[model samples]
Target: MTKYLVFTVLYLAMYAHAGSVVLTDDVVNIRNFEIGYLINSPHTYTIDEAIQAEFTPAPNRLSLPSNQLDIWVRFSVRNASDSVIACNIHNSISYFNRVMDFYETRNGVILDQKHIDLFAWTGDTKLLHGTDSVLPIHLNPGEEKTYYFHFVSPAYQYFEYLILDDQHTLAELSTKNIFPVLLVGMLIALACFNFLLFFSARYKEYLYYSLYLVSSIIWFVFEYGILSHYFGIYGMRGHLTSYGLLSATIFLSLFVKKVLQTAKFYPLQNLALNSTIVLLVLNLLWGVVNFFNALDISVYFFIYAIAVYFWVSISLMRQGNTLVKYLLAAQLFFIFFALFGILFYEGYLPYNWWTRYSIAIGVTVEAFILAYLLSHRIKLLKVDLETDSLTGAFNRRTLFDQFMQESKRISALESLVFVIFDIDQFKLYNDTYGHPKGDDILKIIIHHLQSQFPESSVFRLGGEEFALLFTAENAAAAQRKVSDIRLAIEHLSLAFPESRHGVVTASFGASVIESGRIQNFNELYQQTDARLYQAKHNGRNCVVM
Candidate 1:
């Protein structure tokens, strides 16, 4: 009786252990569950069928207990050759086991995976179930059963919070695209503005700015994939894109060359231009190599920009014009943008669309400034062309243009006064202290005549001679003004140290239109010339009226 009783107790204990539950995450996008109790021995059971369902898994997310936090996760078990494989998981944290709930009343292994509310452990963590053949319903070869499961931890859920991350590269591209358009519009506007300035000013600086603006637009189009995107230049993508930097280098080099005009100072200006041409051709060849090899020519852009800025600045400082000072300002801006691109590519700064496109802003603004400076330079040059360089007075060409218009006024009136003067001993001064010192003496005489005619106008009529047309009370006041001019020239302190005449002096003569006696200005001009010789013959420093 004792033996029988012991056997019964042993059988009960074995039955209880056999009915214990076992679960596992298999090689599928779902979880597998099985009952460890196998009443029929040696029975090969295939997966009867599979069905997809939805349910909330039990939550055990809190550290308090397994049942404290509801646990669930969306999962699927895909067909894997002859078995089921569970996958489609996030590796944000680590690989972990998933828990799955099956609708018990379903015809087959129905898995509910709608509400994920659980934490599954993986790696070296303790498992919730044991490995047993009874726990896993095996399938035949070339057959599969799919199911759903949840992945969650039995205890901490907040510590395993899901982190949102973007996965679509197109989204990033579109976002980047928005910024480049704004930059492109700004650059185009800048170029157009400079074009307007060029038309308004007609200065060479604007010409250079226009060239740079064109190069920049081309560069930006190349940089943004626009060549491929809009222009369908993908077949020539390698050639087009690689040569963009090279073209920018060349156009900008030309701009700098024009901006600084260093050749004006350099004894070998043409030689420098030739060498620069060679460098440009070399850049083009390297660009071809880069296109064939997929090697980025971005570094060349930097090297060329630096080289250009250095050369331009040096040239401008040496012998550049007013436009050069402004170009030098532009160089600083260009260098700043180039360095920014360098730092970004070197990993020293974050690469961003705005950071890349902002170079257009610098170029646009710098071009505008250059355009303004060039326009001003053009105006200054125009003023110079109409004035005498040595005497700082209006030249005879300007005087003649004014004379034709003034003749009408004198012809309308009953009287007018005209005078012509020649420095009597200027030739002696020129023969004495070389031409440069003679030039100073002529300028001194011009200044004296100009100051003496505070209300009248005086003009240099070529070397050592001058003329004036004035309205006076009578011919006597005009003759007095002429005498005053001669006396002023004689009083100047710039004496020729070796003049045979011993001192500088000038003779003047005046003519008056009395009762329309001067029918034509040509006759009046000849009469004044005859009187001028009489003053010189009467001795220097005197006026003949």
Candidate 2:
């Protein structure tokens, strides 16, 4: 819809001269439009007044034929206070050539305008029902400026409009038209950035975030007239429909669960995750139902989706961490107006443009989530300081911690064995094959030994040698297991050209203790180290006690 809309807007702007709003001395009369709100006092809206919204050029309608826009409106900010007070202009797009599309989630609904025929049939820029929102500007104190708005008829909507006479600041300005674009920019940027991040990290979390961004961007496109503008979304007025909204919602929910680590935290969180899955299932069913029933349930679908999203944000906030709390706060930042809009569309309440940007608020929360995860990883990196970079295994520093653990376990159970193994000619291999190859061989051997001692905790006692500590029922069993491991290594097949003995081989030593063993691991180590020396003295490929 965009291509055509851009083309049409451009063609109209180019081939035809658009009517300019040139302000005259004191008053200005719009030729082809209506002046519902004046520079002194713009349009005022109150539900008690039957929602009177005055349009310019009378009748509050526009017919843009070859750049001749028949509809227009003027909003004038009037300082109606003792001091310079800020005012605002707000407009709601009520009707457009909306092509409906439906999708299901939670066995209910998911609304994405792109599912409409217009998305598939037309360009995104076409003049469809511009579901876009605009910002109602907050005028400065005592400022008097008339802002004019014009739109073509089919893309025009006459909804409850308001020129706010509040003391709002620039910070409190509500985005009307540019809101969607800013949201789209945020979502698209997030999508592209996270998509690339997934490529870099290649983790499921990144994929979830990336998908969330993508869904958000798609939603932006669907929400704005972009999809309908070109696709003529409503073209399939009587066909089957499904929604991309389900994918967006489900992925968003899943991403949140994963990021917050809430799924495994409690039964309720788990239940929420499961329920979201169910919602997704139900949503799919409804999507199918809507596909066949035309685009009938689109509005209901979104209403439910909005509810689910809001629930997720609330749930996250209730978790009460700084990150989750801030996330919730960010979501709440946009949710009030969104909920208000829901009230508007549901009842006679006027739609709030603020509500339309719930997704933007969502993006903010998600971005913060991303930052939190990154920082969390950084914290973990600091704690896991004793790991080999090449193999990611515990290094020398890890042994000190392990030593204390083994000490406690040994004192409690008294049925533990310690085994020490040293490569027979690791230095020779290293010299012959180069240091890099030697490092590779050591890493492989470490991996093999670590897997071999299934019941034992293996630790690298610096280079070329490793130690294991484990509990067994008896000394005999422990010795057998240790011997068997040596035999397995001797018999193990490997590809090491520098190895002297057919394959890489190591000498092993074992010491079994039920009681009256070495007082501490250092003494126990001395005993085992002696045994290891005995093995090397006796023969290379054997275990000794």
Candidate 3:
């Protein structure tokens, strides 16, 4: 029995030194290094027992599969320098909410101890500046110390550790964080720009896009530890991270539905998009009630939502939707890069900047492209609303707007002439030949009128009624131009079988106003209508000026 006991003690001693890291330089990267894990709760094993626990090498990065277990990691550092050295043990992941107990021991006796709880908002105040937990160590030349870390979290956690000279650690951390800081700044600027656009255009899609930017910015700032330095809020990082991700998903879905007009072309995809939003909302509610495990299941839902969005975008692109091409280009890079980033964080991929800040870069490109698309869409909608579909002339709304603008620019020496004309005996002609033929005759008349008075602005006031505004050199010139248009219509001699003259005819009325006169469009319209009445009474096919 005494021999067996000695053998067990020897085995424990050998296992404890198996994962030692020999420190021979100024810095040591402990990532993916040999380490041992105790997959039991903290209370289940003492520091000595944990040191004797079976050891396994972690992946390039370490990740816990489930949140319900506590993991104990053990590694040793041997100081090979000729003089005493001071170093800092740093864990760069700031988004995890966990409690860590660090122990340093020599010859089976603990020499120093420290505790860091990311969710407690206390402990290791000096470490706050670096936005992570840090342990300072002093080791004499040729001395070796074994370290143990007890980590407890309720969600998957990541670990990336580095040991560096204490003096240069803070400076190096600042330099490493510069790019993420710039990324968050750019995202905030984009959010503000889109927010202002939403107000100016009153477009719901712009509002959704702005909200998406805000959510993404919040997630990036918090995930990258930028907010951890200034805020004392603890235990809320995981919840806030989940909130930002879920809200971003909802906003992105809404924005795509509106921008792509999915309801019209891809109704099934639109329905699926909405369903994902509802599921996200439910997940958010679940998170609110149970904060610890809120994101454990919701992350999969987020993946599904992103998949639905990509499918809809691709389907639209396949249908020859030009605007969707921009969406596809912007979202494709973002989705793939973001997926890689998440995998990297979960320890499925090696650490790199592309995997770290992929979402930020993707979002920046998306914001610029989407803003351009919104502006272009607004311009096209304006054109559609202001144009007359039938006659290709400016509609009444556009005519009024142009007239108001022209009135503002008129000089004292300029003269404005307004002309109103319509088909004579138009009701009788329509009653005899039907409305389709009447429409064709109207189209022919408009074609001729537009050709004759190419220099003037024309408008179709209503059925069988048209108007033109001419700013010629003088009133005489305007009158001569009007007479030419009247003579051209008579020469056309368009056949109208039911007319008394067996031909189409029209009457014209004109009202000329000198530049000095301050006359509104309503006044000019009345004067022109009176002249039109006189021309109709004097027998159709004549011009009254």
| Maximum-lDDT candidate | 3
Model 1, range 40-124, lDDT digits (tens) per residue? Answer: 1133222232222233332111112222232332222223354342222222211121332322212254432232212322232
For 263-335, candidate 3 gives per-residue lDDT tens digits of: 8777887898899889988987987888656677877887888678678778877778777777777677677
What lDDT would candidate 1 get against the real structure?
0.51
Shift in Å, residue 211, candidate 3: 2.3
lDDT string, candidate 2, 60-139, tens digits: 22222211212334433343334443333333332242332211111112211222233244433332233322232332
Give candidate 3's TM-score.
Answer: 0.77
How close to the true structure is residue 462 of candidate 3, measured as C-alpha lDDT? 88
lDDT of 1 at 238: 20
TM-score: the better of candidates 1 and 2: 1
Residue 484, candidate 2: how far off, in angstroms? 40
Candidates 1 and 3, the one with greater lDDT: 3
